[model samples]
Target: MHALREVGVEVPEHTLTAVTGPSGSGKSTFLQCAAGLDRPTAGVVRLGGRVISGMKERGLSRLRRTHIGFVFQSFNLLPALTVQQNVLLPLRLDGRPRDPARARELLARVGLEGREGARPGRLSGGQQQRVAIARALITEPDVVFADEPTGSLDQETGAGIMDLLREAVDRQGATVVLVTHDPSVTARADRVLRLAHGRLVQDSWAGTGTVAAGGVPRDAAAVAGGGPVR
Candidate 1:
């Protein structure tokens, strides 16, 4: 069975693009394919102008370690590692020099400065998610693919996670592709694309207008009904 079909979307550099749809609409499949976590049956997956779909698993692994970061609904932090260690895992995986200062700085940026010594088991869901965010950015990846990043958080915590993602684009120039189901979360994206039954259905710029078939902007609001883009 095909999880997705005839899907083609381009995300501009340094932008936060949100993918939204109802459950089982292939949202997560799209993210996994785009991020090179899973191979697509057809069509190419490109990152930084390079085609990744044809690359071998070893090559793809290297590409992800150096250029891509991921955040998931489960947080995915290692329970055995302290917050600081968890944040530094990416750097260590890439065989790069460990920079404790950088890890501490990221922790501080994520509002977890004093909790670095704490393990994931001892932290609240929000704090653990913050640590995950820090870990994702620790490598300063060219792109971050977040899958339901806020799905497990409370409303306020979820909002905070969104703010951090925006900061990554604005402050670090990292392109973010977020998969979410919440309209409120979609409101935060610079561009919003909706999928239905594995096909692209809506494409629009937040607070601007609907995007036409060829990616041209029409006069409609960012979302369909002129809802606040936040």
Candidate 2:
């Protein structure tokens, strides 16, 4: 059976789109395909102007390092690196000049101003997640794919993380595609895409209060006020 079948989605820039579904419903598969981590058996995946599904692994790696950002549930921090180092990793990998000032600003924005020298093991779960968030935004990526980013935190801490993501869209104009089981996260997103049996079963928009089934837009130009299609 296919992990996803005939599922099409167009996410606008500067908007937060939540992907929610039951266990084993292919939510993660959808995210993986969209983010160029997994190749779909069929169909095309595009990001900005590029067709990601056609790209080779080396090209995908470069694109991920330079234009994409990711935040995962496990924190994914290297134990040996300092908090600052973890946040600057993408820039280093892409051969960009290290901007310590920008890293400091991001750390301060995420409420980790003075903890740059500390390792991830020294911090609490919330603090570590904050560091991960700072890392995700350090590159100023055009798209961020977060899979259950707040799943490991408490209610208050999770809410705080959600606020940081919202600010990324509102302030930095970054598009966020998040996968979560949390109702609070779904409710807060600008749009929600629910999957079942490897298909898009429901699509809802918070801004317009509209819900559509099998959300294959006839004219994506009319979706979300003229953003890039796909």
Candidate 3:
């Protein structure tokens, strides 16, 4: 993308990296590449040691379905579909069967326990985002990518969403990588990686125990024996 190159954003190699900076700092560009939605100008994009950048569009789609989960800022749910349907869509797209119980569990974890039958338009902004979060985690993808996941909600709702994400990170063992201009969201992040013109400029890895495998931040190497990121 013109914006991506203009800002000099590059794909990250850290297991857990945070892309942060000013409005034009290239955080979105970094997320697009990390999520395999955008390709880098001159670097390989990998997930779980697989070279996804070289894959064909269909292959890349498959890779994303199987390995990546993305949460958007807008709560991109289909108005025509019910909450359960929207959450199950990604798994269905990959030809994976849906599990109502599992889907319900995820929604409940995000604090949307009894609203699975409601339409996106019928819910509050926070509730819609909760559906989005539930959808994002439905597949149990190896890596979860959230681009400004809490940009539009009130603090209370945002905190609920973050707790759900942290729950996934701890209970599901699924690696989470998100982007935002908000510091509150990053407080729970295992590491923080700042970006300026698209390059990694700062890394704050909490420690090996801060997060699990494949969750390293840029500029911070794996702790020996995987003890911590800090």
Candidate 4:
């Protein structure tokens, strides 16, 4: 993770990044801007070779619906819907046909095989998180942005969720941007990015051919110290 400073900080693409910071340090600002959920005061956000900030709402909406996936700390499931129904929300929202079979397959993939009919309120915290993951992946997005995704779970449950996210990235070639203040979550990332006082404080790259903080290397590992140059 490296912040490109033409005007303000911007994270470059194609690697796993764990974002951390104190409150109001711009972790959420960075991610929302990066994902086009919010526009920044300055800088650019590029993902999968497309610049995110300048796109029109229709285009961005299309991009988000078809190419991007987001997982929030709150599972954000429909309480009245079954596990399968909740997972299918995205597909349904897009005016697409319901595919019950595909829904069950995804639930099974996330270890929620037989719990498909249970409503969100009836599931455990970890189970709900799994449903959120399944919802994120339903569109087969290029990059999955998870914002404090495990904030409410216990250590073991959080680890399980991280395992699922990692497997999705490693096995499916999906890029991941995980935002959290937790070191444990950061440790699982192939690369880690730290932010402080509204700027990127560190870009830890941990993998073969990983580069220094300033260079955004694919398969990076974590490093501690001064932040990536901004």
Candidate 3, 1-230: lDDT as tens digits: 33443222223332344556787766776676767887766556667767776678998898888888888877789999999999999989999888889899888877788898999999988788778888998998878888888877788878888887777778777788888888898777867767665444565666533433334544445422211110
Number of clashing pairs, model 4? Answer: 9
**Tens digit of per-residue lDDT, candidate 2, span 1-230:** 66787777777788999999898888888888888988877677889967998899999999998889888767799999999999998899899998889989888876789999999999998788878888888898999999887887788877877888898899989999999999999989988888888777788787555456644443232222211112
Off by over 4 Å in 1: 211-215, 218-230
Ten residues in sequence with the least summed lDDT for candidate 1: 221-230
> Positional deviation of 69 in candidate 2, in angstroms?
0.7
Candidate 1, clashing residue pairs?
none
lDDT of every model, 2 decimals: 0.82, 0.83, 0.72, 0.73
TM-score per candidate, chains pooled? 0.87, 0.87, 0.81, 0.79
Model 4 over residues 169-204: C-alpha lDDT tens digits? Answer: 778777789789888998787666666666555666
C-alpha RMSD (angstroms) for model 4: 5.2
* Model 2 regions more than 4 Å off: 215-230
RMSD of each: 6.0, 4.4, 6.7, 5.2
Q: Which ten contiguous residues of candidate 2 have the minimum total lDDT?
A: 221-230
Query: How much lDDT does candidate 1 score?
Result: 0.82
Window of ten residues with lowest summed lDDT in model 3: 221-230
Better of 1 and 3 by lDDT: 1
The residue-level lDDT of candidate 4 at 145 comes to: 91
Stretches of candidate 3 exceeding 4 Å from the true structure = 1-16, 207-219, 222-230
TM-score of 1: 0.87
